[model samples]
Target: MTEKDFVPKKYSEIIEQGTVSWQAPSNIALVKYWGKKEHQIPANPSVSFTLKNCRTITKLDFSKKDGQEDFEFEVFFEGNKKEDFKPKIRTFFERIVQYSPFLKDYQFEIHSENTFPHSSGIASSASGMSALALCVMSLEKKLNPEMSEDFFRKKASFLARLGSGSACRSIEGDLVVWGKHKEIKDSSDLFGVNYADEVHDNFKNFQDTILLVDKGRKEVSSSVGHNLMHGHSFAEARFAQANDNLAKLKPIFAEGDLTKFIEIVESEALTLHSMMMSSRPYFMLMKPNTLEIIIKIWGFRKQTGLPVSFTLDAGANVHVLYPEKDKVKIFEFIKNELVAYCENGHYICDSVGSGAKQLSEEN
Candidate 1:
């Protein structure tokens, strides 16, 4: 559906006060999107594996405020007031106030917490913003009881994208694609679409073990990295390559070609960093331990002839991807050889998950 279709009509019911809570999961892009356009649109299509354990639980309490001209909200993280987070939330509200018109009419208390460390290479913004968007949509559902389930999900995803581009992928299950690609049916730059193609049994329960190489704030934010792509020498070529790889992944996924999957997934991960390093005033997000971990993974995979591989987000952390069958051996391998590379030996074990969940609703 087009963006215009998400615009809500006048509320049929007046709801004075209520609370909505939602849980949204983080996602790892198999085909990474490194650049973006205006309004959080991806420059290249990306597909992600929705994660189960790394998630954010958000609770929003709303009450009608008398004669409030601007949106009113307080942000909290893990029960602690986070004044620093309000600007971002305000920007998000400004971006989405058009579609969720009721936002300004209510004063909201947003309390959120995450299962994983924030800004540690995992997509915390993705899960966080998506949970918030879903909570807001739940409020909308109360006002418009007749809203279709499909439209609700799509609009929630659309709203999530405005907050964090990858967040659109967090609203759905095992597989999701964002950014329009010719080969992907119904794909849109406006929001993520569930990957409906034939997915083989090999990927049904795929695993991702995230090794935290560094838990520090990113030196260069993702927005800066994405903006650098505007005049990047290799920007066009990289964008084309991402689309080509996505198309290639479709057939590989359907056929259960683990070998081809590894090739593409790992390549996509490295290529993402390559773009970062290649941008003018180049920067390197990968730490020494990050490279060491990648090397160890390669050695272990080749030594055991296991279908094990690695992928990275924009930071120093590494996400080890493998099929369920190899999980036992891979997990053992990680603990023995790779855990040494993680900061303070901290890491998280997660797998493919089925979208967001609504925890509670109260009026």
Candidate 2:
């Protein structure tokens, strides 16, 4: 047979039957996914992009040794070995096996590395778990070639959610919406859709710039923050506000109108944080410098009457979104005003990019 007509007959031969590796970039939510009702499953659906620079690369090797199944996992945070991350690693693997019962008998060694600082509020969970999910799905494909890519992605996302809530969104494309369906417990309902599906057609020219004001680890985890809000006196009101924001933002995003998108996003972010503030043991993620930078950005916007807007996750970093072409002006203003307040603060600029894809035969 000619080279053009030749094709591998076995999955093992085509897949190299060895180590499988996958890498995915971190994502910052334009519409944040805060608070989860069922095991941190997000109160309202959210959308985010797959970042380019900040990413996680994961490699998995499966081999039978001494007729026993062995699992080894390691996580490196910014090039340093992280001993404290072991529990989370173990938990992730267990969840993976639980979802894919066929993987329980294999001997696996998994290694993961992150490109950015662990505590920089760069959505490390988004990249790390997404990479893990991709790696697991690749291994499954090698084991059973008949399995479809869509099946693997959906199952892998369900597995990844057991590790981190935001991880589910990372499995899909540039803009991913998670927790849209109410039946989140049903693994079948947790699937993701590509950003280009006309779901967010309205705000196409958006770009995100993350200003790292403080890289210190957050005092309150999303889980903890959510629990605090649940018990807060304003819980009912906050939930209502989230519902209203979600409904309003959908049409605004569909319309692709930057003005309406900015107004709703900024307001939603503030409202989400207000619930956190009203918790019995009040706390604030924003530092003095964080507020200063935000104020300066708002002041600049006021002067220029720009449609730029800012939002924050459950951390101190600030995410500013504006039209891609207007980035230069935004960058200059942010740098000048934020320098005094943030000694170690740095900025990362990114636009929406394609979602997870196989990199090599190994992946």
Which prediction has the highest lDDT against the true structure?
Answer: 1
Clashing pairs in 2: 202-256
In candidate 2, which residue ranges exceed 4 Å CA deviation? Answer: 1-17, 66-71, 74-81, 119-121, 181-189, 195-202
Give per-model TM-scores: 0.98, 0.85
What pairs collide in candidate 1?
Answer: none
User: Candidate 1 overall Cα lDDT vs. reference?
Assistant: 0.93
Global lDDT of each candidate: 0.93, 0.66
The TM-score of predicted model 2 comes to 0.85
Model 1 Cα lDDT, one tens digit per residue, 6-124: 89868788999999999999999999999898999899999999999999999999999988599989999998999999999999999999999899899999999999877556659
Expressed as tens digits, the lDDT of each residue in 214-298 for candidate 2 is 7777887777887775667876665566556655655666667777877777776676677677787877887777787778878
State in Å the error of residue 3, model 1: 1.6
